[model samples]
Target: MDCDLLIIGGGVNGCGIARDAAGRGLKVLLVEQDDLAGHTSSASTKLIHGGLRYLEYYEFRLVREALIEREKLLHIAPHIIWPLRFVMPMPPTGRPGWMIRLGLFLYDHLGGRGSLPGSRGVPLNGPFGAGIKPDIARGFAYSDCWVEDSRLVVLNALDARERGADIRTRTRFTGAARDAEGWIATIAGEDGERTVRARAIVNAAGPWVDHVVGAARGAHPERPPRLVKGSHIIVPRLFDGEHAYILQNLDKRIAFAIPYERDFTLIGTTDVPWHDDPAAPAISVEETAYLCASVSRYFAKPVNPEDVVHSYSGVRPLFDDGSTSASAVTRDYVLKLGEENGPQILSVFGGKITTYRRLAEHALEKLAPFLPPMGEPWTDREPLPGGDVGDFELLLSEIRRRWPFLSERTSWRLARAYGSRVNRVLRDATSLAELGEDLGGGLHTREVDYLVTQEWARTADDILWRRSKLLLHVPPGTRERLERYLAR
Candidate 1:
């Protein structure tokens, strides 16, 4: 196979690049060893906000860019990306309230925050934050956006496919050799081995970037990718409202407890230096205990390991910054273009989900010199697949009117997950009988079929964990049944 661009890695960066490049009229090929977003991309805190904590490190440029992108993304994908308010409890033990207020003020005004509301001081003792402990008397509420991180990756891949990009999951790039014309790349999949010719190559493999660069056949040694591990835990909902919380740990690190999947709260993200292989970064017992303890300090209801419904860990392929502390490492991305000895190879390092779209735009800008004429930057104004809802509430009402038989909860779920694509998924199905067997909870065989046929779902995990959080709703036995069915 031959192509204009060959991107390795199916994570958010690679998928976003594929989408942007393909839409620009380039013949693009994206290959992933595992499923798309099977790694760090799916394991994010799922926020599309400017990093508030990054302000302390003086990452103004990155934070400003991310903040601007937040509103842009919300406008483009109202169904999946929506405004979320975060409450930061001002405890006497941590940073002073004045300092936090200043940070919030800067965060509110740093970017051109148009559609999202501005930050405000909220009384922690009042009804808005009554659940918080009395010691936390004051707090600040700020705007941000929540995203289905994994689904974002999938949608980008889908959009890329629609724009004429060859997206291959479960396909591995074993090696690549630069020749006089371009690159001769070796790829292996379930079927076997094949060679691909491309004028340029991109190593967007998160966490595996260094491995790819090192494995490139006859390529000069490049700067190694620094790997850092971050972990998150899932527990029962901690509060009654939709707002998320940003808590400060005694160690000065910040953690987030965001509402997730209707009934559960997603708490996370401990940054720890990781020297192990990036492919398998598991949550350590110390990290889990630290997370529970941090939440327990603020909430009346103590959270323990037993309360954790699920836990995940991911390795951030940070660009080597020589920082000793993992938390101090940069979250910004850097693109290394043109190889030391041969055809151009672009390697990406250290990027967050919130900036993936911008990262793609930057990557393509760097590669424009080598490629032919292409389309202009169009993603900033375009919506992702199923994200064209002009008004979210109207979309919800339309779903209710169309599926009057569906429970309000089910209708909301379908609308949020599929957005405008719900119509296609439910085409020609009038009644509950046409929806097929109820696998469990709100899941039905029809929905699973739609995922498999359209969303590249090949296993139970893809449907339950990546495509949707049906695993938390379904019975344990049902998962096994679904797994068995898919295995056949």
Candidate 2:
């Protein structure tokens, strides 16, 4: 196959780039070895924020860019991204009130303040302190965002594909050789090995970026990616409100306890140095204990390792800035455009989810010289598929009006998951029975088919874990039943 850009990664960055490039009238090909967001991207803390703690590292530029993108993303993908208020409790031993107030002040003004509310000091003795320790009487509240991280990635890929980009999931890019005209890349998949021709390449392979660079260029990266493992744990609801708590530890690290999946609290994340396989990173016992301890320190109800219902870990490929500690490394992205050896190849390193879109824009700007002429940037102005539904509450009401058979929860889930595309998933179905057989949880056959046929969901895991967070809510045999259906 021939294309203008060949992207090797299916994470948020890769998919975001593909979407932007394709919308600009470029022939884009994005190849992923597994399902979109099957790795680090799926395992994020599920946040779209300006990395509040990053301010401590003096990453003003990154924070400002991220804060700007935070509102922009919320504007474009309102269904999957929404504003979240965080309550940061003041600890006796942690940074003092004056310093924190200054930090929050910078945070409020950094992004040029948009629709989201500014930060404010709140008494922890009131509702914000419901489950917090009584002794910790004061704190601050600030705005961030909650995101369905994997869904964001999938939506970007879907948008790219709809824009005429060829998005191939479960296809691995082995290597590529440069030539005068462009570059020829090798890719492997279920069909077999094949070669593709492209004028330029983007190595947004996330954690495997260094490895991909080594294979394609026959040399390791000059500044190899630093892999830091971050872990999160899910437990029963920790507190009674829609708000989330950001707990500070004496060691200078912070952990969050956010409301998750309606029935659970998501507590995370610990920064631990990792130098092992990036494919499958598991939370160590120590990391789990640390997370529990971090939150337990402030909450009126103590959390223990035994209370953890589920835990996940992901290795972030950060730019090695010689930071002595893992938590201090910058979260800003670096676009390395290499044209010294041959045709141009841009390798992305050290980026957070909040800034993926900007990263894509910057990447295309870097690669513009080598590739054919393309259109001006437009991804930010338009909504991702299913995001056009304005006034989410009205949409939810309309969905419930149309499908009275669906429970309130199911209706809300469908509305949020597919947005305006919910109708496409429901089609002419007017009753629960018409929706098709129930798999488990709230999943039905109609939705499964839509995912498999439209969303590149080939396996049960893709449907259960990545396409949606149904795994945490579904019953035990749900996977087996879904797997059997997919096999047939």
Q: Whose TM-score is greatest here?
A: 2
Tens-place lDDT digits, model 1, residues 380-484 = 998999999888899999998888888887898889888999998888778988988777777778888888888888988898999988788887687877777
Q: Candidate 2 lDDT, tens digit per residue, 190-212?
A: 99999999988999899999988
Best by lDDT: 2
Candidate 1 wrong stretches, greater than 4 Å: 218-220, 340-342
Please list all clashing residue pairs in model 1, or write none if there are none: none
TM-score for each candidate, following the candidate numbering:
0.97, 0.98
RMSD in angstroms between candidate 1 and the native structure over all alpha carbons: 1.4
Candidate 2 whole-model C-alpha lDDT, 0 to 1? 0.91
Q: Local distance difference test, per candidate? A: 0.88, 0.91
